[model samples]
Target: MDPRESLIPPETLPDLLAPGLRLISVGLNPSPASVAAQVYFAHPRNRFWPMLNASGLIDETLSPSPDSMRRLFEAHRIGFTDLVKRSTPGVAQLRAADYRAGASALRMRLHGLAPRAIWFQGRTPWSQYLRYTSGEAPAAVWGLQSQTLDGVPVWVTPNPSPANAAFPLDVLTAQLASLANWLARRP
Candidate 1:
């Protein structure tokens, strides 16, 4: 086993998913901090929660925690999942096999759940998903993509990880707001 495997907890993170979800946010994978906190984007510096709230996607602000995630699901019809289920200190620890397996599993979930739309938190998850599932790594631009995943509309946004400082919180919020607008326009 990889030395990093020893550092990861046996339970990484669970997918907050349900049938007929209006939108599902897909991250590259769970960070060690998120796994430890039992919440998605739990790192203190991560901008996901703040950006999500400022985006006007949901009326109330939500902190990174199990209850907040449940609120997003039960109240707003939003959900969360990751391309890879494993928790790693950094993406460098992930292997090609991990992406392949994750992409396969994600494909199955998307087909089964039939979420109205998918919001990929960063380019990596979508690129890896495509490469592993269809042998295609198309250039991914931010915002909604022409391609659909099993007929579900796909949207991309800059990662909210603190490490992705290039995209400030405002930009992330704007991207998410655009997604919310699109969701509203959908029948």
Candidate 2:
């Protein structure tokens, strides 16, 4: 049986790699805008770039251009991926089964990459990932901090998406700041 046929392999996904991708952000799926741009989290309203900037994770703001972010992500040794290779407009559009399946696949990739951490944004995805994984993995800040999952750290950060208005800009910045601090020590 071909395992590749059952799910979207990492190759088919819009993945980024640097000198050695130390951190890989695992998203539930690509946004429609991201798919169109072939960049992760490319939506104009998405707060991802701004959040990273405020957090100090990125020294400067990534221009709202998808192409630019790609270059930046690569330069930083940070990668982006989605549980589902396809795109959907909103989280509500996804189903429980999707999270379960995505979680299962993610564990496999987490092992393959051997990244220092697998950061998941949005609590929904994190909770779903935890549930499907059958137990706890390291929990990281906003999802931040150093913790281990099968020996690799797992960090959970606030979803920089506009949909998550609960985390105001300043608060989000603080959370990301913690993440930045952790990352700083890693290298």
Candidate 3:
């Protein structure tokens, strides 16, 4: 397939996920570029990978390719998933119904998988999770939350999308480092 094609591929990126992980990073949804490339956080401008490395969560930096995902899960005990499974050109393209259904499904999955902690990449997914599950849309704080998901701790951070310029890279990196520190202190 020509890489320039804007068509959403039949296949989207698969979740690099497993049960009993130390950390699970959740995204809002797949970007069209990520879908077309069949990789998570694959957009060239996306800083998820860079910030992940800077945080020192993993032993080394990882490429956002499917091939590198195994190392993340197997060695680092980190996994990835998204609140919504569908790919869109932008988050605005996602509907409320999509968030509702996705949040419900994610709740069930997290209950089953039982990761130690969940780090939501942005506020939307976490907010939708609270709204759908509890009927209250509370404002999100970008750090460890008071709530727990099936006994798993929840963390939030600014979205690393190139579109989210409000949080500087240094701030984002610091948030991730905080998360890393929290994980280290856990038994």
Candidate 4:
């Protein structure tokens, strides 16, 4: 077994969040690998770190680790969380109840943090969040959405999970770049 697995807690991955965050990236849920490593998007093929570095959002390249993520939160004011906290081998293990609870929890966190904008890693988390909170999941596009989470702007990007092969790294990078450009214009 990997040494990182010894660090895993029963609650799985912990949220990397803080007040006054400029942006928050929300994933669908934590994978077992991420939980073991105690890092979001820890999987080698996930493309999250690579896409983030290539998007020009941050000046430095970040490897998948707790320290790198902490630097992102502290230095860049970019936080990380998930629609669901549970770590599972696959999305098929998740249930509607999970989304419901997670959405409520996420709403509370966002309200408390009041980040300038939210960067959803995929449409599922955004749509599920909307569905659970509003009783309807509106059709969404790939970039910025017209909707806001209680006045916090929302931006959606392709899921960086390697399982989501429909989108390549370049596509994900471009989408993140768009979000970066939008953030640059924010007050």
Top lDDT hit = 1
Q: RMSD in angstroms, all models?
A: 4.3, 5.4, 3.7, 3.3
lDDT of each: 0.92, 0.70, 0.86, 0.90
Candidate 1 residue spans exceeding 4 A from truth: 1-10
- Candidate 4 lDDT by residue in tens digits, 1-187: 9999966565677787887788999999999889878889998889999999999899899999989988998999999999999888778999999999999999887786788889999999999999999998998789889999878889999999988999989999999999999888988
Report backbone clashes per prediction: 0, 4, 0, 0
- The per-residue C-alpha lDDT of model 3 at residue 6 equals 50
User: Which residue pairs show collisions in model 4?
Assistant: none
lDDT (10s digit) by residue, model 2, range 67-181: 6666667667677777655567888888877877887876666665666666777666777777778666434345553445577676777787878888887877777677678
After superposition on all CA atoms, how large is the RMSD of candidate 1?
4.3
lDDT of 1 by residue, 1-187 (tens): 8999977765678888889999999999999899888899999999999998899899998899889988999999998899999888788999999999999999987786878899999999999999999999999999989889878899999999998999999999999999999899888
lDDT of 4 at 99: 99
Looking at model 2, report the run of 10 residues with the lowest lDDT sum. 10-19
Model 2 RMSD in angstroms: 5.4
Candidate 3: C-alpha lDDT: 0.86
Candidate 3 to native Cα RMSD, angstroms:
3.7
